[model samples]
Target chain A: MKNIDILVDNATCLRGDNLIFDNISFNLSNGEILFIMGPNGCGKTTLIRSLCGIQHLENGCIKINNVNINNPECNFLENLVYIGHNDSLSENLTTYENLEYLNKFDLSNKDEFISNPNKFLKFFDISKYKNYLVSELSQGNKKKVALSRLLFTNKKIWVLDEPLSFLDEDSKNNLIKLFLDHITNGGLIVTSTHIDFSNYFEKSKYLNMKGININE
Target chain B: MNISKIANLKYFYKHTKNVSKILSFITFSLFIVGIFWGLYIAPKDYLQGDSYRIIYVHVPAAWLSLQVYIVMAVTGFIALVWKIKIMEIISIQSASIGAYFTLIALVTGMIWGKPTWGTYWVWDARLTSELILLFLYIGIIVIYSSFTDKRQGAKIAALLAIVGLINIPIIHYSVEWWNTLHQGPTVTKFEKPSAHITMLMPLLYMLLVFNLYFVTVLIKRVRLGIFQREKNTKWMENYLND
Candidate 1:
């Protein structure tokens, strides 16, 4: 067994003059699920943003496989996938093109995924919107297009922020199934959600950002 | 430290409150002096007479049209590479402001051309390249707004701004490299400005006014934009109260 998959130590973030959250620490391993459940505006989004390396931490560090993710010598980028609270889709590009943009940036196992984008369009049941500009698609369809990036690669860590907010019931079930498949394939997921996805991942544990930790 | 970039947007707004007020005062006062000097006080062209007064406005507008694009491209490079949110806002505001000034330069040039060059329009390299520069600004704005997610919209606009930088040099050197009705570089000559002291002072004054005006507009527009984007957030509320 690996010693650790993700190690976050004393992660601190402050908003304005107030501390939104501080001294957050956690650990997770492959095939394990870490669900960050907090109330709205409780810094769930900020924490997720910090882990994805999108938001700078006021203090502390995050390491993947014992190498600091922020370190110049670390090669953790190829292994991390961050889906922010926003869909972050370029509406000018078609759904397929949006998927292709992220897929082209993969540093490893690049060639195998080129032919599979259309297959992924079908997997997310968003095939009809493949040629349509992402702006023209419905909100749920946009989320699906965003989620399709997960299908195109085998990234090790999935950092998702409020992923289930706009998803339909069937899409939610499809997402749960995909999560199970990803974990079974030795991938780790750290997600913040208002929705309870515990029924889907039985072993999933919760981390509260109110300076309290409740183990599963 | 790759993701260690910070966006002190509120900080900018806080500090620029007094600066923007001062700049607006200075730029407004200068605009009055510059227009009055160029139109009523400065000497007219020896050849074109009264028509050449447009140079005070046309030349500075055209110059800034290119300068602001450079700002956008530089900001785009930073935003894309470093993923800084403040740089993204600067790039977006720059495109709108650049496009506005590009339109001003084009219209003033055509008005100036009617008397000097015998026609109001020409398809010469410099004019066409400047037209394409307008198109590039439009493209960035259109593509940026097309995205539902404004942050991703910023990324797309940043890419377009960076790609559009190729046209800047073409617009700058078009008169020198190709035959064009537009006059050659006058105030910005590599060796020295060729204009007489009588004609040069007002153009230089307007250039300063144009640059200061750019800062004034950028500070106000970006502050308003950040407020809208960060609506209902604690930082924004605090900023508004402050």
Candidate 2:
């Protein structure tokens, strides 16, 4: 697999008077999953948004595959997929339509992907409700649809903010396995989880937000 | 070069930084000059006399009212095709401003009609279509703000705007198609204008002025909308901090 490098340098994020994180730097390469462990309200989501280039940095920059993300046209978005705290799925759309719409921007193998949105749905155990409107689905199923977006996106950098929060244990384990399989196939994953992922990832690094000063 | 490449180049150049603000300022200034020339410098008509001066305001308002809808429809197309948020913002703001001008035109037309046509209002083709144009604008804005999910709302609104575009041409050509109290074309390719150069120049100037005023106000409204929608975004934070 070719080396894929994601670097965030000297980043500072602020929400109101509270400084979420400052002077933060990190690097993730191919086949590595970096686990960001932080307490509630510690800017983990803010960090994820900044890395995705949806949120701007107060102090620094994020480089994806050696391209500066600030330009917006640097093709960085094509390489990265972000699933934020809110499930960005359209409630009025059926699960099938949601997946199809999300995959519209992707130039990947379309036939292969479309033929088996059911495959991921089955893996996530939401196959029975595959045709259900997203609004009618349970919270966990909605999250499943949001996560399913990642599978169809076929991007290298996956930035998932709290992917396991709304899932049951079995679904959580299934997701972790999916993450592991993604990393095994040479894709990079950066996830923020309050729950411990120590058992799933052998070399996962943790960032504790409790120790960081919020006022600075 | 292929049409697609030429279009892509046009799109790229259109979105090039610093273009919107410059166009906005120039259009705004022209609008101001047009308004002054139309409202004051234009010669009074021999028959209609002083009351004909209302045409300066009425014609421009009517033109921009329709023009703004066309702008919204185009921007709506862009928003849906490219998923560009800025396009949606432009669409929403343009609709609001366009609806406002359409209302102004209709009301002023009624006032002018009352004095000249012997009725303050009539269910005439041009006036009725103009009213419908106002409704379409209102419908677009209502659809945009009704939903909690902004993306979904924007998509629906864009679709609504595209569908509502049928009303624009109808409003423009209504006076010609039907024999009504509303006068026919002052300016059209197929027919010679009834207006003399002395009166027509000011009417044209007012048209220009109204367009500039729309551009200025639309820019301000769009910027405000952008700030509101992107309040939580980091770029918005940077803007606020600055």
Winning model by TM-score: 1
TM-scores of all candidate predictions against the true structure: 0.64, 0.55
Q: Over the stretch B154-173, how does candidate 2's per-residue lDDT look in tens digits?
A: 77888898887865676556
Which residue pairs overlap in candidate 1's backbone?
A: none
Report the CA-based lDDT of candidate 2 relative to the real structure.
0.75
Model 1 residue A25 distance off true place after TM-score fit, in angstroms:
5.5
Per-model RMSD to reference: 8.5, 9.6
Instruction: Kindly list the per-residue Cα lDDT of model 1 for residues B1-242, writing each as its tens digit.
Output: 42333337767766888888888999999999999999998876667779888989888998999999999999989988876778888999899999999999999988987886678886555566677789889999999889876777887899988877975676557644654335444312223335788678888999999999998999888887777666666767775676
Task: List the candidate 2 regions with Cα displacement exceeding 4 Å.
Answer: A8-25, A39-64, A67-161, A166-187, A207-216, B1-51, B67-97, B115-125, B140-167, B170-193, B201-242
After best superposition, candidate 1 residue B160: deviation in angstroms?
1.8
State the lDDT at A79 in candidate 2: 71
Alpha-carbon error at B16 in model 1, in Å?
A: 2.1
Which candidate should be chosen as best, given lDDT against the real structure? 1
Question: lDDT of each structure?
Answer: 0.80, 0.75
